[model samples]
Target: MVDIPVELPAGPETVTGDWTVGDREDIVLIAHGAGAGKDHPFLVGLADALGAEGLSTLRFNFPYVEKGRRMPGPAAHAIATWNAVVAWARTQEPSARVWATGKSYGGRMASMAVAEGLVVDGLAYLGYPLHAPGKPEKPRAEHLPVIATPQLFIEGTNDPFIQPLEQFETVVSTCQNARVAWVDGGGHSFEVKGQKRPAAEIGASFARVIAEFIRG
Candidate 1:
């Protein structure tokens, strides 16, 4: 476990993280989505799988989640947390390559941070919310094209957040280096209708694809 300090407008806050050491030279720093924290089974399973794959994993919470808030504090705060976590990770194993990834909101924040010049080798999004469901008029993609690092988008074919796949495809097309891995018939959390599976199991399933993307 680690405590990462983030300076928010209100005051300085500390976020918590769990580091699972692996036998590899690459370090994957993961952030939680809007709802969950570092310990969620979904994230835990992913980290555990990464460990088995010999990839170091560090899962951490944003400032808001650390403070027990249901909603994210602010994009700036989340970005600061990303900055802190990445810096901390680099310090721990300066020779290790660092990659950033997270579920939905957490992953989006990472892109924003990278766009704003937070250094990271690459990024992977578990599920990117292209737009609010049914409202593709506005997109949160302006900064994506500016990011030069390799990016991997693991999206579910049936996720409402990216409803109207064509628009999402266009956004990806603009990226400097990005690719998508679609989950056939899966939902936002990779939940396939009529198929019952624990969140951890579902999360763990994505490990191989994500690991491949990282090493690619």
Candidate 2:
């Protein structure tokens, strides 16, 4: 594991990341959600599982998280952070294909960054927050249509952020190359109802799903 300091041009703040080398040429740069840092158990589990599947992984903290703030910073900062991390990842393995994957807010920001002209081979959303809880009328999906890269949205049926299933379906339809993987009874964190499991176990199960998508 190599510690990387991501320097942002705006605040000049340094965000930290942990890089886990894998045997595959496909590299994934993952970011955390609003409430957790890159070292969150769920993300660590996911990174480990992906590494086992032969995909290199880089998990990084957002600027606010690095500062120990519970609330996330503005979208611009998150986008810049994504840019910095992806840029640094490219330097590590120039021949490797880099994909962007994130949980919730992190995923959404990745999409936004891609729409704003960030380069990535593909994208995966662990659990996209289509809209704020109980605010379906204000869906955050205007940028999905412009993102031409292949995308996989792993969502839970019980996620309040994307309720009334049809809404999410409609939003995905606008994308040129996007698909959904519905997790039965799963919440925003991919936790299934009444099915207790360790965070790592749950993350491992999704590794195959994501790897298959990347391979396709």
lDDT of 1: 0.90
The TM-scores of all predictions, comma-separated, are: 0.97, 0.96
Instruction: Give lDDT for model 2.
Output: 0.89
Give the Cα-based TM-score of candidate 1 against the true structure: 0.97
Runs of candidate 1 with Cα error greater than 4 angstroms are none
Q: 1-216, model 1: which lDDT tens digit per residue?
A: 878787777888888999888854899998888888888888999999988899999999997777788998779999999999999888888988999999999999999999999999999999998888888998899999999999999999999889889999999999999999999998889899999999999989988988898787
Whole-model lDDT values for every prediction: 0.90, 0.89
Off by over 4 Å in 2: 1-9
Error of 1 at 44 (Å): 0.7
How well does candidate 1 score on lDDT at residue 6?
78
User: How many pairs of residues collide in model 2?
Assistant: 0
Tell me which residue pairs clash in candidate 2.
none
